[model samples]
Every structure is written in C-alpha cells, then in structure tokens.
Target: MTDARPLAFELPPLRAISVAIPLFILAVLLQPSVSARTSRRLRLALLVPTAVLGWISPFRWRIEPVEFAITANFRWGIFSPYFLMLAVWFGAMGESERKNELAWLGFDGKAEKKALGVEEGSTGHSTATKEDGNAGLRPRANGTLLAPKPRPVSPLASPALSLVSNSSLNDQLPTPSPSPPVDPVQPPSVVDAPPSSVNVPTLTSRKNATRSYSQRHHPLRILLDAAHLLSAMRMIGYAGGPRARDLPPAPKNDKTFFRDRLLAFYNAHLVSSACLALQVLDRDGILASYLSYILPHDAAVFVSATLARLCIGVSLWVQMKIGFNGFAILFYLLHRGTNAFLDTLQAILPRRWSEELTWRSRFDVREYPALFDNPFSKMGEGGVTKFWSARWHFLFRATFTSLGYKPTLALSKRLGVPKRVAQLLGAFVVFTLSAWMHWQALVSARYNLHPSPAGLAFAAAHSIPLTSIYPPPSTSLSFLDRNGTFVFFLLQPVAVFLESLWVALTRKRVSGWAGKVWTALWVVVLGQAVVGKSWLALGLVHGLPPLHLWSWHRFVLPTCSLAPMPVFMR
Candidate 1:
C-alpha cells in the first residue's frame, strides 16, 4: 500500500483555495450583518467555481486507487457540493428565520421575540434595498409616501417556507394580498404568509428541529448542527418527499443508553457480516461465476451485463448500509465511553463541581435518532418517485435538490413554464446532477486504477456488442464502458416521467405489484446498460476491504472445520 503510485499528474495548487472559498461563503452566511440577498448572490456566483475547484483538487492529491476512491469521492466530489448546497439553503432562508438564529438552532424563542417587541416583517430589509434604496418609495404627485411596494415574492421561497413552516396541515390556499395597513408599531404575523405546498418542520418545532435545543448557544454546537442539516438525510428538520410519510415514527425519547448500545452492536454485526460476504463473493470471482451460471446460455452480452449490474447494485446497497451502521456503532460507543468517564468523574468530585460540569457531560442516547429508516418497508408502493424518495437512501437528496432540483424549479416557474413541465424539468435536472456526481466518481476511480495499455485496449475492444459468459476474462469485462455509469443514473428521471405519463393516460398511479415490476425493469434490467463494465474495470468487484473471516476461523478457532477459500486481493 505504501508503494502504490499516485493517481494524478501533480499536486493541485488551488485545492486549499477551493476549500477556503466554501468556508468563507459559510462565514458570510453566518454573519448577522450580511443581508440575505447579498449572501445569496455571493453563493450563487461562487457555486460553479467551487464545484470546478472541488472537482480538480482531488485529482491533484497523491493516493492509491482505494484511498483515492474513499477520500476524494467524499471530500471533493460529494461533500464540496453538499456544503455549497447548504450555503445556498441558508442564503435562501426567510427574513424571519435569518433574524432568529436560535429558531434554526431549535430554540422556541417565539415568546422571547414577542416579549422583546420584535414583530415578524418589522425588521430586516428586502432584496430591493440596493436597487430601491428608498424602501420602494417613489415620489407621488401629492408627495405623500406610497405604501412600500409589495416586493414580488420569490419562487425560490417555496422550499424555504416548506423548511420553516410549523405545520403541514395548514390550508393550502395561495397567499392573499396584503390587507389594509396595520399600526406602524405592529405587523401581521408570519402565519399570515402563504402555506408551503410541501409539508416540513418549523424552526421552532424542537422535537423535529434540525438541531438539539440544549446548549445551542455554544459555537461548537452550532457547527455540529450545521453539519447535521447539511446532510439532512432523514430530512429530520426539513421538508421531505412523499416517501417521508412512509418512514417509521421517530424513536421515542424514552430510549435508554443500554438500548442504544444494543442497537450499535446489532449494526456492527451487520457491517461485519456484509464485509465477510463481500469478501467471499469477490474471492476467486465466486459472485461473477454465480452470475454467469445463472444467466441464460443465449443471453446477449448486454443482457448478461444488465443482470450482473443488479449484483453490483446489491453490493452497493450493502456497502451503504455498512457505512451508515458502522458510523452509528462508533457514535454509540463513543457516547457510552464518554458517559462512563463522566460518571466516574462525578463520583470522584464534589457535588458543586459536578453540578458546574453538567453542561459538558456526554449526550443522551435520546438525542440521536436512527440513522436510516427501513427503505424496503414500502418498496414500489408509490412508484419510481417513492423508490427514490422514500425507499432509497437519501444521503444525497439535499445536495441534489439544492444544487439541481430547486434552482430548475424556481427558474422554470419564473419563466412561466407550465407547472407539470416545470416539475419534469426539475426532476430531470436532479437526475442529471446525480449522473454527473457518479460519473465523476467512476472516472476518478478509473484514473486511480492506472489501467495498463493492454488492459485499456482490451476494455476498448470489448466495448462493442459481443457475448461469451458472465465472468469475463480477468473480470475486466468491457461490454459497457465508464459512461454507462452516467447513463444508468440519467435514465432515472425518464422512468419517473414515463410513470407520470401512464398516470396521465390511465388516471391511476403505477402501484402495487405492477409498480414492483416497473421498478425492477428500470433498475435491474433495462437501466443498467453498461454499468457493469465500469465497476469491473475499476476492480470494484472486491472493492471493500475484507474482514478475513475464513482466516480468523482457521487460526483462532482451529477446531472448527471449514473449507479453504481464495483470499480477496485487489
């Protein structure tokens, strides 16, 4: 591993610059003095450059294939855009939310604001401050000040409202025009604003708030909260898709540390088992051989690759679960150990000292929720939309939406595009971004592998239509190239639109068993195209580091009878 060659030509000089830019943008957002409009403009202006920098920076770093895949794919490819998306989300926040950071921190400070005579819409200038510095005031023929022009509401505000709105059950009526002027000292309540089309949690809804209410004033806590919202996988504090409705209710607050520990151990066991299974599958190409044997004798190369792609999909799903669960276990153990140490200290110290240190104590298990919902629980019940929204892991949803879907939707609305057409365009944009993200990962992984001239030639040679078997020579099958990875993701939105078309014509959704078949065909068979070649060429079949379960059994449990198996190798 130490001797492995670096993937890129040289170290990128602008990598640190790329990183600093986003942090700077975040800083601007956090600043109370910076107006929301300025922050938004700055963020929008910097997005492309930030993406370009992140994209290029990882390639400059010196690392082996495995290391590069793990480090660069996250730090640069995924997280860079993720952080930017968060910045955009923050920039797009409403004035009421911007004025009360505590609200975002999960503090229900509405009473406090009221006591301080801080009325909603009373503070904070609009985006028109720069252009119409006179507060939208223009000289009338009578020289009387005309009521400040009602600033045209932003279409982008839809998601922001969805995020901060307290209740989903509110009437879905379009916002009424401003009523006759109230007293100068008081303003209409924020509740008077139009309800968001999408249902999500309000900033004051502590139970579902993005951040924990306790210790929220602490800077470190704020940073942690920002990170939590950045990922927003479960959409715990924000608006979620239709699938969110299917999620099991949040874990009750009565959950104990012991229960959390058990949960952690359970997840750890799953991770271990997955790693072992993946190792077994990779060794001697057992999975490859199995797929080959199961495929029909007359199956074309495309058919074989498509079927094999399902295995890759399963492998990816397992890997995702492993990572999520592994992190959960680590967090649980850390909390357990910290609490144990805290208890020991409290027992040794005086009561006064312990009381003073209470705020510094470890987090309660109840503060953390389950990392994932059971995605399989309601599979195919809602069609492709539900599959991606409710059934699939939502780790990338926020990033995809903020960077892709939201902007397109907003722009489409602004352009007078029909509502349905706008939705389709927005969905397509989201998938396009997803496709680019995966393409970048695959391309980076390919570069790191440092394929030889012979291997490259062979890969190119097999790119065309040809058929032999599932487990091709050297497991570097090339019936599909790296571009297939992009194609697979790009087709997702097409599936969604097709489903919509079906509904439009048939007056019913594609659901039940029929929905299952539809999803399988798109995901397993027709959609995979050439993705298998990309993974196989990257030597990703045995991508994960194995646990060496067989070796452990042979050496540690010598009395146990087990057959010898091929060891996994890169």
Candidate 2:
C-alpha cells in the first residue's frame, strides 16, 4: 500500500479531522443553556470554517487493501458533503427549533441530576416525573437511575420482511401485531417520584451540581461529553426518528435485543460472503463466457451484456448491504465495549464520577437505534417514492433534505411557487445531491487505487495477478461519465414524477402487482443498465480484497474448468 502511493498527500489523513472538530464544536454549542440568538450567531460563525475545511479535505485519504474488503473508505465520497450538510443542518434551524427537533429525534435537552451523579444519597429512589417526557428510567447496579432515553424496537422484525422468500413480488405482507402502547416521549419504567419524600431536584440545582462536578473533574467531563455527543451523532442512524413509518412495529416480547445483534452478524456474513463469491465469479471473463454458453447463441450480444450488467449491479447492491452490516456490527461492538470499559473504570475512579460514568455507559446502549429497515421489502411494495423515502437506507435522508431538498422547497414557496412544484423542486435537488454524493464516492474509490507501475511490477515480480492489484479498467467507458451514477439518481425524481402523474390521473397510488413490475422496470432494468456498467468501468470490484470464504471454482463446482483462484484466494 505504501509502495503504491509513497508520495501521496500526507495532509489527507490530518484533514480528515476537519469533520470531527466541527461536530464536537456544534455539540458543545447546542447545549441547553445556549440562547437561540447566541446559538444562531455561533453556528453561523462556525459554518464558514466548517465548509472551508470540509471542501478542502481529500476524499482519497484512507484506502488500504483491508478497506477494499469492507469499502469503508468509500465514505470519503460523502465525507465533505456530510460535513457541509451537517453544518448546514445545525445552522439552518434556530435554537428553539433545534432543541425541539432534537427532542423529537430522541435527544434529551434537559439536564439530569442523576445523569450527572448530583443526587448524592438518593441511590434507591427513582427520580423521574410524569412531566419528564421520554425520561428513560432504568435502575443501575446500585439502584440509581440513568439519563432519559427512548426505548428502541427490534430492527429485524419488519412486517414487509414476511414476504421476502415468497416468489410472488406482489404478495401482501402480513400486518405486524401492534406493540403494547408506549408513550411517544417517555419510557414506561419511569415511575414518577412522590414530591414530598423524593425531594426532586430543581433544574437550577441539577445544573449547579453538574457545573460543580465538571469543575472538579476539569476536562474529563468535557472530553467524555464530546465523545458521547460524537457517538450520539453516529448512533442516530437515518434520523427517521423513533416514529419512522417503515420501521416494523415493536414485538410484544422484549427479548429481541440479543436476537437483533445475532441477525446483524448473520446478515453481515451472508451478504459479504455472497458479494465476494460474486466478485470471484465475475472476474476474468468467467461470467461472460458462462452466460454466453447458457443462453442461446442466437441471443443478441446486447441482451447478454445487459444481463451481465444487471448481475454486476445486483452484486453492487449486495456489496452495499455488506458495508451496512459491517458498520452495524462495528457500532454494536464499540458501544458494548465502551459500556463495559466505563463500568470497569468506574469502580476505580472517584466516587463522585461513579453515577456519571454509569449514566454514560447506559446511554450507549439505550440510545443506539437500528441502522437499516428492510430495503428489499420496501422495493417489493412498489413505487419509487416508497422505495427511496421509506425502503432505502435512510442514513443520508436528513443530510440530503437539509442540504438540498428543504431549502429548495422553502425557497420555491417563498418565490410563490405552487406547493406541488415546490415539492418537485425539492425532490430534484435531493436527487441531484444524491447523484453528486455517489459520483464523488466512485471517484474517491478510483482515486485511492493509484495503481502504479511499481506496484504492478512488484506483482509481476512476485508472480502475482494484476487483477489483485487493481489493474486499469478493461472497458472503454469513461469512469466519470454523467450517464452512469449521476443519471441513475437524477432520473429517480422523474420516475417519482411519473408515478405521481399516474396517481393524479387514476386516483390511485402506485402499489400492488403492477407497481412491482413498474418499479423493477425502472430500477432493476434501467438503473442497472447505466449505473452497473459505470461502476464496472470504474474498476470498483477490483478494489475489494478476496475474503477467501469458499471459492466458487473449488468447493462449489470442481468439474468446470474455471480460471484458477485469483491471487491470494488460494
């Protein structure tokens, strides 16, 4: 890796911190006491530097052979956009609105006496009040309370998932059983303390106690809180909020937490192994020859090639799923380990920080949200709007909307545009941003390859396959073609418009069997034809290192004379 790009810019690695610094600053500035006007001013002041640093940061910072396996560094494509979007997201709204929005998004704005370990001797008593909306009240090991949290539902129980294995795409999914009514703002375990004996601390006292403790701890509180805030931002997946429409209803039984983790692991392994196997199969003209042999010789070359492109596109989708699962696993382990580490350290630390540490530890698990909804199930339901808005991974929805969609809509409305026209404008902007993000990602991934003569010569000298070292793309198509990634996303709004037009004329939504066919025709057929080939042209697959998880030519089909295992797979 070093040999491939010895003189590669050193600044790219340091510049990556540009995103984190602004986020930490925003976290600090958004604390409850900051006035709306002050927050607005501070945020406005911060936005300039944030945007500047974000724009200048290199996308080709962290690419190694290992990252190719997970495509982790591909995020560089969106890193700048995300920082810009997040900065804009914070700056666009004033303090009151921001607090309300964050509260609705399950972030507590109120200072907690228990959360800061200010309630010195009240270990056995519960401190939550009915008015304390969404106050998550879980008892600690020493019977103290943690901070307010919103209860999370199991991620794997999507109602749409019931029909995943059914051959018919149009199968109506079974309605999930409604969970026991939960308070939108408060967890059920929060038993309101009786006023007389409980001596509920006032807000001022809570703040005072927090201040005193922080003063004593000096920078520890600040550091921990910033880390906590950063982790919080990461944990707030998709920003669909707790009431996301696509989220499956919570189950009656409450034991799905461990089960959900297991499912995530299973999904990561299944999708990753499948993607690698597909990669291996697609290598060295193997899939092309196989398809040609299997299909009639009379089949048009265009048809066979289109089919191959579709296969590659499906593999791309699988690769994306692998990344999602990889992140999910990584987050779960990180949060769990952080909590355990905090617990172990708490005992050895000063007594004043014990409950504070406990608060932070529990906060890790309590606030962790599900990363993805059932995207396939979403697609099978039909309609591009449903797929994009509800079925797709929503991690970037807030970013796109804040950075593009909402602002456009607002500007259009202010300019006296019709509501529908404003909405359409917003949708287009969202898609445009989406296209740019994906295009940049592809560019970043390609840029990171930097396949040098030395690297190739080294491969050759060691009798290594050039494919393993990311040989230049064999296809004639340009890597940065606008017709590929850009067009695919850009055309989504048009498909959405067509669906809207159909609904307007027919007085019906685009759903059911017909909707399924319509969606497939647009996304699977048309989308894959352009985007899939574009990705292949960019040499995206060659970036992924082999997992060596069972070779297709070895265990799967020994009789077939397939190309030998590519490079390190053997």
Candidate 2 clash pair list:
134-185, 134-186, 136-149
lDDT of 1 by residue, 95-134 (tens): 4434322122211233223322334555332222332223
> Candidate 1: where are CA atoms >4 Å away?
1-224, 227-235, 238-246, 253-308, 332-377, 451-479, 527-530, 542-550, 553-570
TM-score for each prediction? 0.59, 0.67
lDDT of every predicted structure (CA atoms): 0.44, 0.49
Write one digit per residue (lDDT tens) for candidate 2, span 63-109: 33322321334445556666666777765555423432232112232
lDDT of 2: 0.49
lDDT of 1: 0.44
lDDT accuracy of residue 547 in candidate 1: 30
Error of 1 at 156 (Å): 11
Off by more than 4 A, model 2: 1-18, 35-38, 56-60, 64-76, 91-93, 104-242, 249-255, 296-308, 311-346, 349-360, 363-370, 378-382, 448-451, 462-482, 543-569
